[model samples]
Target: MTILNNKESMRVTLKSVTVPSIPLAALLVIACSGLWFSSYWGARLALFPNQTTEIVNHLQKIIVPNTLLSEIISFFLTLLNAFLLAQINNKFTIIRTRTFLPILVFMTLMGTWNETHLANGSHISLTLFILSLFSFFSMSRNRNSSEQAFMGSFLISISSILINPLIFLIPVCWIGFGMFQSLSLKTFLASLMGGLTPWILYLALNFIINPHFNVLQALILNPNFVLDISTYSLPDLVYFALMSIIIIMGIVGLYSTAHSDAIDTRNKLNFLVFLLISLCVICFIFINQFVSFLPIIALVYALLFSHPLTLKQNNFHSILFIVFCVINLVYAVSKYILT
Candidate 1:
């Protein structure tokens, strides 16, 4: 009869490979590198500009497509965003542990898809939104955070100029402030002022540069309320479904472990959950229009996924993580190799 010993069991169990270890870090690096190469290869072979690229080109009066330079810029921007994500978690302890899992997960997700390889308005908007989050998360439990509120709203407004759909995030920020217990009449007014500042400046600049700039034409607020799944292949749909399942698991892990966290941490996690739901709703309502926002969605998804994959050390979660990695690999192969 064959029997398994403790050492052999430990070798098979993922709990033995904790987050802050060298093996996990090396594995993350290898996986991200492979995924990045696949995406880069795909983008190099074909550069397709979606609707968001056209809108951005029209608004800016400059054609910026997915070129080598744009791809490089997008890659660097993603790295910067990953660093900022890690910083947010470290500074706020949002994940309740000091782990680089967020960065790893974020970079891996960014590398998984070809659409994210191009430097577009969405990348710029996501960068600004993350910068704003630094201020928003910092305002926790501080009623006198009007300055932070203004800065946060200001950055978000600037991002909205790049991606009009993101303007909805202004109200989301207000709701987040309320959740953070930092909302006040003063902060509310400041946030409004901050949100309007970009538009005011944009209008003024357009007036000086060209009086017939047609602000209404530039600020197109069209929303096609359609569940546009026609663009996605069966494999793509399956990959998204798997990702959704992981996100659901992360949400469950978050709530199941909520009582162990501090009040501030709980509030922040709740805000993240709310923000993720809001993004999903926006994506669903305007999938065709907001396709560029996938990178932003990936950012939030990575953070949420990191919660469970980092904290929950069980056979189920471990197997889930392994499955997640394998799915990504298979999807990449199907996307870049098979097709």
Candidate 2:
């Protein structure tokens, strides 16, 4: 593909993506735009493939290794998860279910890179990814869901970390997601530790089996780690800032919805999720070396768990989200193209 000038590229983008759902499609559009956006940064970051810059080559690298269509599928799945969850909350009158969808968001990061720059393989073989969704639905057959759902989620998260140990931190997401429920210290701790335990077991197994994999050091730190440009963008920073506001609005909305009585389970859980995400984000800010993926985790949850709004309300915020996404992509592109 030729490096058309910026105006030409933008025109081509509009031509390729003209649609009736321009407003709604913006969200998905921005995602493809993001991949296009990453083309620039992929060249600049140029750490992976570890060689000279190549913009078109970088764009071609859209699909991560070992997960050919993971990005596209994950994005679509994220949409399905969000909508189904909102419907679940409305129907069951129970928001504490800890449905498998939130966990799916975290586990999908397995398709992402790691600190050692290894692909961090999953527990199940490649075929099991689809089965994960099946298991989630299958648990409904017997109606024994809470423990089973979480247990399935636990196994999946564990498998995810094995694929890439850094993913352990993703449960920081579960910790957040759990907040909109009971808020018991015991249950919350279980969620937190459950997310981490896989990596611990991974370390233990490696220590006992390999005896010299430097499992602890690798898990603790990665001296040679280079930032995954696929993960971040300066423009997205604005969206993150908006995400903070969305969280704030979510809190206010929940509070208003709660009417400040004795504080319901939903409110408690919401508080927990918000606090946990905040903690995760703060920790990453100080220690980016440890969890470069925190923003992705935080942003996903923020997008997932925001207060339920009407069609217009959702459309409104979705617009804000897309605008921020667009800015981030443009900045990412500039970083790529200018450098």
Best by TM-score: 1
Poorest lDDT segment (10 consecutive residues) of candidate 2 = 116-125
Per-model TM values vs. the true structure: 0.89, 0.46
lDDT of 1: 0.76
The sequence of per-residue lDDT tens digits that candidate 2 reaches over residues 1-339 is 011356433211221121224464455444443453243336443332221112223433664532425334444543443444445434433233323223222232221222212111221212222233233333322332344344434555554443333344335434433433433444445445655665577668767977767754544432344446566655445545754675565545545544433333454445445545654554454343333333234333532433322111333444443443454445545554546
Question: What is the C-alpha lDDT profile of model 1 across 1-339, one tens digit per residue?
Answer: 012258456322343333546776777666686677666556434344344433466733443445556666777778788888888888888888777767876887777776666536777788999999998988888888889999999999998877777888889989999999999998888889999999899878987888878877767767778775787789989999998888898789878888888899899889889998999888776676555677788888888777876777666666776787788878877876555
C-alpha positional error of residue 262 in candidate 2 after TM-score superposition, expressed in Å: 14
Clashes of 1: 0
Candidate with the greatest lDDT versus the true structure: 1
